[model samples]
Target: MATFLHRLGRGAFRRRRLTLLLWAVVLGIAGAAAAGSGSGSGDSNVTLPGIEAQKAYDVLDEKFPAANADGASARVVVRAPDGKKLADSGPRAEVRSLLADLKDSSPRVAAVADPFVARTISADGTTGYAQVTYKAKATDLTDADHNRLDDALDDARGHGLTVEASGSALAPAAEAASSEAIGFLLAALILVVTFGSFIAAGLPLLTAVVGVGLTMGAITALTAALDLNSSTSALATMLGIAVGIDYALFIVSRYRSERAAGHEASEAAARANGTAGSAVVFAGLTVVIALVGLAVVNLPILTAMGLAGAGAVVVAVLVAITLVPALLGFAPERVLGRASRKKSGQESRPKTTASKLPAAERWAAFVLRRPWQVLLFSVLGLGVIALPATKLELGLPDDSSKPTSTTERKAYDMLAESFGPGFNGPLMLVVSGGDPAATKTAVAQLDRGVKDLTDVAAVTPATYNPAGDTAMVTVVPKSSPSSEQTKDLVHSIRDRAQGVETATGAQALVSGTTAMNIDVAAKFSAAIVPYLALVVGLAFLVLILVFRSILVPLKAALGFLLSVLASLGVVVAVFQWGWFQDLFGLQTTGPVMSLMPILMVGIVFGLAMDYQVFLVTRIREAYVHGADSRTAITEGFRHSGKVVMAAALIMTGVFGGFIGGADAMIKSLGLGLAAAVIFDAFVVRMTIVPAVLALLGQRAWSLPGWIDRRLPHVDIEGEKLGAIPAPSEPGHRDADFTPTH
Candidate 1:
């Protein structure tokens, strides 16, 4: 592998212009393709094929087509400002005129129901709502369609009534692009400070942009055939930028170090590519494998998100090895800028032994002196953070979770104020495939049973379809859609409706936004164990191959688990338990989004492996050269600690920027990832790992001879850079370092 990388690096240097030109061409093509194939925000529906709830949902749609059409329904709310009754002649006439105008506005407008005929006026007579159904789903609606609705509502706002339109079809404000821009700016600042070179800092950002651009294009094109959610591209961009910068930063920093050590430009670039670049490849694989392991859950949205993120990582890795090296070859010395040159000159002069060891190395020595204390402290701290994970709840965020500034949120609030909180998400009961009379009687009985249940606000009479086999009942809950009481109400209704099914021989199925969310949460919860096992187990096997040590892989797996749990616990506390909710601008508290756990597990685990591979590989390389475990630990920390800290900080900032987005889900995801990176890099990688290795001593690197011999040789630590000389040889540095094996 080292030989192949060396050849590739040397070739890239020899053909630097050609390599740059090739990447330029690829970038142009990707940009054009992405522009031509505009992006899509995925459908809001969470479909789980083969699940009982899904089957019930499908049956309800089939039997009661009017209630579950392909289109979306919006509510146009009207309020009287002067305390005038909305049922009065002036306000009522204006609302009627608006509804009539909206119904005739566009071909996309399927129908608009009258507030008077539908009895949608509030009991206080100061507020009322009109229903507007479109011909397409919310995600499928065109901009022009939304514009027409906006125009009609604008014209309808007069005559003592204020009109506001809100519905699923009206898209929420997208803050992802702005958030990414902020993240990039912050990353650039961090990079410049870390590298002390504008050119060096710019290169990683450029590589990340190119990789993300190409991957987003491919993801956009993929939407033509696959059902990708709207947030998938944003997520892909986030992961892509982070890994791209980190990967290139690693190689570039190594190249500078080699150059500073007096190696020629080409030799320095080649060696860096052969060493840190190799680690980058292994790290990229860990991330991709963990991401792709989302397929184990068999959920389409998650699968799409995982694959999209994995694709970005793959591109980032490729660019790191190919484009980054070629760019470095173009201007090897100048890439590090003036500050680096001054530092290199200072290093060239003779130095004392104390100055040779950096602060990180000294800290390593300090930790080793009290390994047991550091280990116990880190474990206890992580355990405390992980406590809240035991009470973690999972569910999809509803419309009410949107920012208050959004029209959807405003509409939700207005409806809840007027009609009750349950108005936002009402449950539908479908009784199908039975005698018309029998179904009606069964529906009536079920309605009576549900209306009497706790947490139920109202139950409407059964409304049968034109076909005698189908009937529907709408149940409204007193609590909010995302509340535990609402979810319990849904389950209770489904369970009790079975009695009516037995008597009337008509199947009763619960189908609505609340029920669908319940099903999604349940499905994700059931799949969590398998998803974790698959990702962790696969990561374990890969690490074993790379590190060639059983204990190393075991330790890495356990550390990753701890980091993920701790991160999740933080999310549960902030987003679910409502601790410091005001700080994050959260209007309400609910369960953590159902998909957060698995998604965080995959991303955090991969990232944990990323640091582990970079840090441990250095230690292993030193150990293989006959340094004792203790010396290797200190040496490895000296070599990689600063870089790891910079990388982790940059990643944390990038992820933290997403918390400013309008969506609560995105905020939770950002917080969790950022928290995980900080803990893994600082606490786990720096403290626990070194402490564990110190205790393990020589056993840390042990592997069965037969298993080691059979395993594929992986050289991530650049052992093949040159042979190690004997410790007794003249000018040998190994003897200067104390051995504690």
Candidate 2:
């Protein structure tokens, strides 16, 4: 593998101009294709195929077309500006006129319900809502269509009325453009400080952009043939930037080190590619494996996202191993700067001794001196942070979670204030099969039963289908949609409806946005354990195969688990418990997003393994060269620790930038990922790993002889590079030579 990579790297360096031209061509082609393909809008549907709630929703749509016609409708909410009652004749007339104008002006408007007559007016009579059904889902609407709707809503703002809109269509775009820009800027700053060269700092960012662009283009093309959620692109980009910059940074750092060691540019680049590039390949594969493991959950949305993320990482790896080396070859002199050039001229003789990072070496030695104490302290700290994870609740954020500046949040607040929090997410009860008369009776019975239950705000009269095979009912809870009480209410209604089924001889199925969210939460919660197990188990096995050490893999797995838990616990405390809601501008406390656990587990695990591979491979390499385990650990930390720390900070900055955005989910994701990177890099990789290795001694690298023989060798550290004799060395090392620690 090293030989192949060496040849590839040398060839790339030799053909540097051609390589640059090829990448330029690929970027242009991909950018054009992506622009032409139109990546399409996102899907907010969280329904799992074949689930009971999904089946119920399908039956409702099929049976009661008119009743469900506005399933995707947007609500235009108007409040009397002076706190005047909308029930007054003048204000009511103005509201009615506004609705009429909206209906007449927008071609996309399929129908607009009368606010007063439809009982859409709030109890206070100061606020009213009109339902506007569109020809298609809001996300599917064209730009012109959205502009028309926006204009129509704007017209209603006068006449002493405050108007806001909320629906699937009215959802604020993810608005990741600003966040991405900020992330890039911060990444550049970190790289510049680390490399002390403007040109060197920009290379990783450039490579990341190109690789991410190519992957996004492919994803856009795939969307034409398959269904992908809108969040997939944002998630993919997030992962892509992180891994891309880190991968390139590793190789570039190594190249600079080699050059500093007095190797020629071409030799340095090839050697860097052959060594750090191999670790990049292995780490990239681990990330891909963890992401692809999302398929085990059997949800198309998650599966698509996983594939997209994996694809981006693949591109990152490829760019790091090929394009980065080629680029480095063109300007190796600039990479190390003028100071390095002066030093090189003064010391023309080849460097015989490898330079070590003093700070990292001192830190490692300090930890090793008190191994048990360091390990215990680190474990206890992680444990405290992880405590909140046990009480973690999972639910998708509703429009209520949006920033107050967004139209969705305005509408959500208005509705909750005047009508009730439950008005934002009403449950749909579908009674199918049996006699049409019996279905009606069953619906009536279920409605009556649920109306008297706790949290019941209102139960709309049953509306039966024309075919008499299905009936529908709407149940509104007193609590907000994202509240725990609402989730419990949904369960209670379903349980109560079962009794109605026995009494009326009709099948009762509960579904709606709220119920769908409930089902989604349940599905993801059930899948989390298996998903974590699968990703962890797979990562453990991969580490074992690469490092050929049982204890190393076990230690890595435990550290990953701790890192993930601590990150999640912080999210729960902030987002779920509302410990500092005002700090983050969160308006309400609720469960963390349903998919956060699985997503975090997959991503953080891969990242944890990435550092594991980079750090451990160096230690293993030193050990393979006859260094004692303690010396190997110290030398490895000295070599790779600074690079690991730099990469972690950059990744944390990239993820943290998203918190400045309006989306609650993105904010949670940013916080969780940032926390994970910080804890893993500083605490786990730095303190716990070294301490554990020190205590384990030679046993840390022990692998059964028979299993080691059977396992296929994977040289992630490019050990073959060590076989090449240095220009100053007469031959390979003497068998009796042993360096003092």
lDDT of each: 0.82, 0.82
lDDT of 2 by residue, 179-198 (tens): 78888998999898888888
Compose the digit string of candidate 1's lDDT tens values, residues 91-182.
77787788888887668788888887889888887878888888877776777777877777878764556777677766556564577887
Model 2 stretches with alpha carbons more than 4 Å out: 65-72, 81-84, 171-177, 345-357, 434-438, 502-505, 582-588, 723-741
Superposed model 1: Cα runs more than 4 Å off: 38-40, 140-144, 154-158, 174-177, 342-357, 434-441, 500-505, 582-588, 723-741
**C-alpha lDDT of residue 224 in model 2:** 54
Position 697, candidate 2: lDDT: 93
TM-score of 1: 0.92
What would you estimate as the lDDT of candidate 2? 0.82
